[model samples]
Target: GIKGQSLPDHYEIDSSKAKKDLGITFIPLKKTMEDLIVQLADLQTMLEQS
Candidate 1:
């Protein structure tokens, strides 16, 4: 069976199951950019505090 959404971070999948069931995984470019932006902001705040 196919999954409608990606597995949560805490969940683990068997290697064999992943190889057979999940062909490919993709994250949206916008989400990736947003994550990077948040990370950069965190880093900037850390630098300012130091």
Candidate 2:
């Protein structure tokens, strides 16, 4: 039996206004995750050096 339970997903932010008013571009989830990983790694390295 599975111990962990899955929670229902929801959207917190409305993207339509960002696109129409702010001219923000949507990034793919995969690419966004990759970029976050890289940023975290860099931050860790900086912390270790300090």
Candidate 3:
């Protein structure tokens, strides 16, 4: 939301090599949901304050 031109309608990431390079596995579903809920709550709080 900076006072400038906007981004293009497309984007890309070369994450196909992430697993091989980082040695990481899938995220646990429960933890992922918890984190998302926390983030959404934080955003909602900020919106209300603003």
Candidate 4:
């Protein structure tokens, strides 16, 4: 799992409009997970090299 600042206890998104209008894009979970794994691997490799 990843950790970082979270949203406010009371948060909401107006789904009435298209997400793009709100400046948000839809990314599939599998793609996101794969990208995150690659990023972590790259970071780890850089750390080990240094």
Tens-place lDDT per residue, model 1, 1-50, is 46797766796655666656887556789999999999999999999999
Candidate 4 per-residue lDDT over residues 3-42, each given as its tens digit:
8867679968675467757766778999999999999999
Residue 44, model 1: Cα distance from true site in angstroms: 0.1
Q: Residue 9, candidate 1: how far off, in angstroms? A: 39
lDDT of 3 at 3: 79
Candidate 3 lDDT over residue span 1-50, tens digit each:
67797997998866658878997677889999999999999999999999
RMSD of each: 11.3, 8.3, 9.6, 9.8
* Of candidates 4 and 2, the better by TM-score: 4
Candidate 2 lDDT (Cα, whole model)? 0.91
Error of 1 at 42 (Å): 0.2
Worst 10 residues of 4 by lDDT: 15-24
Task: Please name the candidate that would achieve the greatest lDDT relative to the true structure.
Answer: 2
What TM-score do all the candidates reach, one by one? 0.53, 0.53, 0.53, 0.55
The Cα local distance difference test for each model comes to 0.83, 0.91, 0.88, 0.85
- Arrange candidates by lDDT, descending: 2, 3, 4, 1
> Of the candidates numbered 1 and 4, which has the greater lDDT value?
4
